[model samples]
Target: MTPPDQPPPLEPAELSAYFALIEVSSLLRHTIEQQLREAGDLSYVQFQLLATLGDAADGSRRMTELADGVVYSRSGLTYQVGLLEQAGLVARAPSAEDDRGVTVTVTEAGRDVLARVFPGHIEVLRELFLEPLSGADVRTLDRVLGVVRDHMRAVPPRSARSRRKGAARRRPAVDDA
Candidate 1:
């Protein structure tokens, strides 16, 4: 019998799968980071922010929404958005729907940066991440990860805590680390 507070250990195969996922993720991100830096002079988080906003139909999202979408801390996202705002890439404005909400919009400059960066981003993904995977493997991986992502998101991690009613518009304390 196990202690009530003690969780079961991962089986060997589970451990292997977890480590492989971590290592592959690290390798892919390293290459993607280099590409984004060189092509758009943007960090991975910045590119994610810009791309997310660029894809938004209204070309804008509330700061809390961006934090959820990118799985980033509110403070970190704020700093990145500040940098983009300073670069004339994105603009922050009062949300029309909620007076207390701040919406972030990708400026034309941000769109231009995404356009410049996307080709190399796709290439890096293809070369370092996707090239070795078969179509069946890709499909299985996508389906599995989608399920995993959904399961994780359902729990409302720290970044997703803004989804709570009164918390939605409240400024989060810095937890960037």
Candidate 2:
């Protein structure tokens, strides 16, 4: 019989899947962090910010938008952005439409860093994440993860918005191209 105060344990298959997911996530993050640090002297968050900015059509995003996208606290995002600014990898400016807002844009230096780091990043991803999966497995993984992500986004914690005021930032920086 189970203890009155304790919840029932996971089933064997559930336990195995849960542990496997945790282990894979941890291992992948650690490996990627090491590679990123060596290649670009970037923290995982910094790499994420840079990569997110790189993918933006304008190569920029509002501060609050970035905070949401990166799943960071507004204050934490501010600090990270400050670090990037100091490194000349990103710039921040007031939004023209909304003076209260701020926009962050990647710099030429940022692009150069991405260019330098991406090849190795891709290789590591291929080796550690993609090579083991068949095409069908990849598709199934993507679909399953997408569903989970969407569900989580609809709930609390992940759905929580920053309490920071005036985070309605503006347009991206001048295109580096």
Candidate 3:
């Protein structure tokens, strides 16, 4: 019997959708970051951290809570928060019960910065992303994106098996042992 025909090795041209998605995302983030920097001197992540905390009740969110709300990991949040705190864009305070934990709060200056830039920000959203699509198109796009995200998350991610011998729970915690 003859061997079955082999598939070609994956290339950038073969990953058109995936490559386009990543490139577009990078460009969008860079553009937004530039606009933010020009208007209020905030990086994309910093602006998002502030916005996330600002949306939380009492204008504060615990470190873990904040991390889960956004894409950053706990350590990533830590690094970003340190920078924002230094710039006085965000304030870090001890959580009520967890002395080991911190709560992030957006400052008045932060809010002022947001207010100054938000109008232009909305305009950018309108002109670049939103206004180009009809309302129905926007809704459909959101639904499709949601479906794609759900599918991606539902699929188990591949990783090398760890040495720890236990049934994995929700999140993998580092073993200090």
- lDDT (Cα, tens digit) per residue for candidate 3, span 1-177: 334797665677759867877896776777788899899888787788888877777888888776655655667778989998888878888899788888889998878888887887787777767877899999998998899877644522212224366533333232110
Cα deviation of 42, candidate 1, in Å = 0.4
Question: Candidate 1's residue-wise lDDT over 87-122, tens digit each?
Answer: 999999999999989999999999999999999999
Q: What ranking emerges by TM-score with the best candidate at the front?
A: 1, 2, 3
Pick out the ten consecutive residues of candidate 3 with the lowest summed lDDT: 168-177
Number of clashes recorded per candidate:
0, 1, 0
Error of 1 at 82 (Å): 0.4
lDDT string for model 2 (60-109, tens) is: 89887787777786778899999999999999999766788899999999
Give the TM-scores of the predictions, in the order they appear: 0.88, 0.83, 0.74
Q: How far is candidate 1 from the true structure (C-alpha RMSD, Å)?
A: 4.1
RMSD of each: 4.1, 7.6, 5.9
Candidate 3 deviation (Cα RMSD)? 5.9
Q: Choose 2 or 3, whichever is better by lDDT.
A: 2
Give the candidate number with the greatest TM-score. Answer: 1
lDDT of 2 at 57: 91
